[model samples]
Target chain A: MTYINSFRTGLKEGLPICMGYFSVSFAFGIFAVESGLTVWQTVLISLFNLTSAGQLAGVPIIASGGSFVELALSQLVINSRYSLMSVALGQKLSREVTLPEKLFIAYGNTDEIFAVSVSNEGEIGTRYMAGLILLPVLGWTGGTLAGAVAGNILPAIVASALGIAIYGMFIAIVVPIAKKEKATALCVATAILFSLAFKYVPFLSFVPSGFTIIISAVIASVIFAIAAPIKTDEEEQSNG
Target chain B: MDNGKFFIYLLVMAGVTYLVRMIPLTLIKEKIKNRFVLSFLHYIPYTVLSAMTVPACFYATGSTLSAIVGFVIAIVASFFERTLIQVAALSCAGVLVTELIMNYV
Candidate 1:
């Protein structure tokens, strides 16, 4: 495919992802403001961080007078999976993607975009990745703008109801695949159990939320990897 | 926090996050041949998402009952194979109705 064709393909795939992001970040926007951030502060967080959970988690801590160390540590832990994803996506890039281009593209490696790009048939080129990142970025910023700027205009009940939106996105992402694959289903259960245990248990509750996420994901992924190893990429594409 | 501190906070967050992404993409040029490792990474996304989601989901709304209703609605909506927006809209509606009912009940 020509660069334009690949870019167009990227936009096509990105449309659904963009829509998903708009709602999720819309939730993030409302929460950020509710948590004490100004509209500009909230929008800037979404603009630069471009992460749903990390920003959502960080803003609250900051609002409550948490230390800078807490903010940094939590962000690193919550988002560490991106490092692993970066390695995986690195292997899929075309040779034409230079070092700067690779680094540039890597900055926009959100979960939805990673899944879409990796599922493509061939090595991903710069143009395609650019297209993939573009729409989602716009939707993310746009949604945050709407939520932060016009959130007060929304009726109190509607704004409150929208709090469920991000969790809804998470459910949308996980449920279909879990329903199909027993192992992934098991993995989700394991992660949730681990998360709850850490949260409510006596001594374990002291574990920071960032570390808690890493431990749960790593521990559960390790368990399922041993029990039911997925040997092929074909199985993965189907899982998504 | 003042503007300077918040600025520093975001800058650090952005810097570290960019490194986490950039370093891996720049360094790992070859496909990892180890199936054990690949299998492990295979499960990371789902597990991470699941870990981030829960307990939080249960307490998201003003009322626990409304939040639970929304959670259930989101799960049920997912089984229908609807688009993301569809699922989100339905679950939000479910939460709205539940919250409104809670006002009276």
Candidate 2:
């Protein structure tokens, strides 16, 4: 009963995430097919990668006959934050979680799962996180398959425009939190400024997109940490 | 990349990604105690999401004006703490309206 309830809750909580994943993954599928990948290959990549940005960055390299090392480094640069997210999640999880369960849950860690899990209270068990993971993975995979099957049916302009859904989803996730939290707002502003600097500045213009994202995130995180460290217990208690 | 080699590369990449995510949990029995590290971990999602979204909002439509309109709409909608769907719908609608009016006038 507990497992069933957790699954139900996960499904409900994950609906919006699933919708966002579907749209973005669908776009990826369309792009993959147009890039000359077969349906099976596209589906397999989505299932294994489960990362929009990483896949987007990698697809060009793969098409261009880039080396495996280049592909791996690009993926590492883009998806390195998942390591941080996983560590945070590991801290939130019960210490008693078995090795196998931890391994399984780690595979399922994505932006959506991390957001939903971290926002919830208390020690999150593997069971509940698993419920959250399964839904989005399935949604993403299914959506990719659908997109590949329906490839190029829509006009190129429309399909290209729909790619903006990924950005829309990111905005929906960040804007609300930034509005309420000063630390988050600062982090957002710093990241944007640094990203623009990397893009527009003559010397920085040569930096790759994947590296730019990683560097901006690191710089923003550091600045926010220095400027606004977490409040102490006495401060919190006094305020309360 | 040939078909066989591409699949092989993907399998290796997936294995490496999974290992990077899982190894710390499996090996590190002690809790993370460093405050700076913990705080950095706490802020990664926020920083990454913001980094992705901010530029995207401004650049997604290939014009600074559209991005500003989209950001304004998204910011207002997000203040209400609405669901992702609602925020996305409202922002897209906002972008379309802004673009249409710009074109007509």
- Candidate 1 CAPRI classification by DockQ: medium
Runs of candidate 1 with Cα error greater than 4 angstroms are: A1-5, A34-36, A61-67, A119-122, A233-240, B1-5
Highest-scoring model, lDDT: 1
Candidate 1: TM-score of chain A is 0.84
Chain A TM-score of each candidate structure, as shown = 0.84, 0.92
Model 1 chain A: weakest 10-residue lDDT segment is A1-10
lDDT of 1 by residue, B1-105 (tens): 467777877787777677778888998877776777887877887787788778778877778888889889889998887776777788889999998887888
Model 1: DockQ score: 0.68
Stretches of candidate 2 above 4 Å error?
A1-5, A232-240, B61-69, B93-105
Give the proportion of true interface contacts each model preserves, from 0 to 1. Answer: 0.72, 0.48
Candidates' C-alpha lDDT: 0.82, 0.75
